[model samples]
Target: MSHVGVTLGVMAAIPALVEPTMLRWARQTQGYSVLAAARKIGIDEDKLAACEAGYERLTIEQLRKAAKAYRRSLAVFFLDTPPEGIDTLRDFRRVAGSESGEWSPELHTEFRRAQQQRDWLIDLLESEDTPVPTAWSLPSSEVARLSDAQLASRIRSHLEGLAGSSGPTTSDRYAHSSFWVSTLEDSGVLVLHTSGGGVATQEMRAMSLYFDRVPVIVLNGSDAVRARTFSLVHEYVHLLLHADGLCDMVTTTRATNPNTALEARCNAVAAEVLMPAAAVRAATESLRGRPVDEWTYERIASAAVRFGTSAEALLLRLVNLGLASRSLYEQRREDFQRAYVEQERSAATGGDFYRTKARDIGKGYVRRVAGAHRRKVIDSFTAATYLDVKVGQITRLAEAAGFASASGR
Candidate 1:
């Protein structure tokens, strides 16, 4: 068959304007190769290669099929404009070829953004002239001394206070159990999510100029929700110390291991934030006659609900407080995790709730460029590149955000 004939046949079978851009994006985001995507989408190898090279037009049906194969939505595929300004393709190539120890582009970008954000935060604090505590006030060694349980409690308390004062509207932004607070040393939020796996996995985490405006740590939705919460608080302690760099506490399960000083300190900070030892002791004492040793999973769950934490967290607190033995706590944790997994499996869902850095930063940047486009503040190409999606998708997002309505577009 002639090239035109084959192309026409494919077009007739798939009428949608499925851009090869979507395929490239799937490859980048999901770490799939062209052959894998072609096989999964049932597209001919030559046709898929043409689509990636921008030599062939992709039908909307093909785009939807590719989206399904990539486990993403057509809407997400169209959300950002094409890559421009930065050599994203080159960067990815470098990362792919680099040494095993080298950080991923996402991690490198996050590290740079975090450094900038930390510097900005220091400047902000210094500029205030008020008697605010310096980032150095909390010593790293001292921070390292606190137990994980203690640190978790402190973080939780601080967040609870902030949430209470900020009210319900701020709840979504702050009440999110996943947060990082630490002294000024190597401190920043690391938000991650699981993708295409039932087990906890890291999808992407980055620091960007986009999220630098606020000390926010977003995670992927497909991760273990409780584990994500713990990591956030652990990183928050790092932030409180003004520390730099990234740590995958969830993968390491750092809080559970008390041998390492840094992990212990972070665990203490997380515990302090989530459940203050003093408070836990008081609560435990108040529940007189209720055998602390015989604390049931239901009881722990109830405490977790009351304290706005996970049952696993509550059990850990009980162990730390000597109300429950270590063995008992571990058993309960395993049991709870098993049940949680079963529950999630029963629901039959993929992906996670945590927002990736790209999605978060990309969305924010897109919104700004979209506004500029509507106000005639920038050109269409500028809008497309900044937003990282196609021009058509940019228009849709602008309309959804009411930017178009206000600008009479």
Candidate 2:
């Protein structure tokens, strides 16, 4: 073909539109290298570089491809500058058992999902005639030094009042944990569960983000139910202290808390709230009168059930209290963790999708979102987007949540 003929063909395909800056910004913000972005978009590295460098134009089709690859809408590429994105401001996690490193894309995706939940919750609350929700203020430095029993009582009182529960008598583990989720909601805290493929790494069991009054907790639902309970309380402690970051409850004692001070305080506080040391001591003392060497998983398991805590967390407390040998605790920890992981893996296979999704998005939040849709506070389309489901599925979710009047129902 002649030079003019080749130029005419290129011009016809390219449309003379260039968004070189926006393309570069999107790629960089997504942590993609030129080659990686090109591969993601199925373009040659040199060609993609040339397009972003403004040396050549990308066809409209190529622009669409790039937009999809970067996980951005086509409209974003037309923006003059990259929008300020969301991220957890700190790393409050103490990872001990997970092999996954740093932050992963999967984790960040869930973080954004949590943020979306928060945004929608705000909308729903604004539309309702609810009371001014109370936000828990952290104890003063002096009170922060209170013993675990007193601190645990304080946290228990606040959470129980928020949940509207009777007391610490637990008949069900799930029902008990669900109470925490509802309580968090009542207190202006956002709780979201991210299960299977939830965190970038399995090491990341839970994460929290404190945005002034809107504190958010993202728990790894893939962990044991009892573990999830501890995670919820751990994250609650983070919100109380306004220290938001990803966390792994690898070890609950001060040994796991990097610093001997703030981090330790958070872990100790979470431990107290979840399984008051006094409660554990009472349970252990009441155990069928066994010598220290005679203590076994069976006995500890019984105590754990009574306290509404995992055998692992309660056992660890035993080790910390010198009631059980560190060696014995380690042995039990290994056994319980292995079993917990297997149970989670088994449940992940052929699990109920909507139910799990409901759990991942928190039972309280799902009900409210579905309720908002039912009352026409928000349309199905908006509800679906916030719930991260197809528009048609919104109705089923609403029905499941007992909000049957919504068009989705």
* RMSD, every candidate, angstroms: 11.4, 4.8
Residue-level lDDT tens digits of model 2 in 1-409: 9999998677647743756898887776555779988997787999989988989877777787887776667887877766675553566554554322455545656776787778877767877865435555555683557776677678888777666674454746677676677678767777788766545435577888876656788888766677777788877777766677777765644443343355566667777777776777887886536766556666676677755677777777777676777887766678776765675567555667787887788766777787777678888788888787899898676565445643444
The reply for model 2, stretches above 4 Å from the true place, is 1-25, 28-36, 46-59, 78-81, 94-101, 127-132, 135-149, 195-201, 252-261, 286-288, 343-350, 402-409
Model 1, runs deviating above 4 Å = 1-175, 178-220, 245-259, 282-288, 292-294, 343-388, 392-409
Query: For candidate 1, lDDT tens digit of each residue in 1-409?
Result: 9999998777657655445565686655554567777887788878888987778855777776787766565775664454353222111111222312233334433333333333434343444432333222234575567555554544444454543432121212224432222221112232333223322233232111222323444343344445555655565555555442234442223433222445456665666665666666665564434765556666665555534456677677777667777787666778876765664468554432222323333233334456556657667876665544577667776554345565674
**Most accurate candidate by TM-score:** 2
Q: Highest lDDT: which candidate?
A: 2
For residue 185, model 2's alpha carbon misses the true position, in angstroms, by: 1.8
Worst 10 residues of 2 by lDDT: 252-261
What are the lDDT scores of the predictions, listed in order? 0.49, 0.70
lDDT, candidate 1, equals 0.49
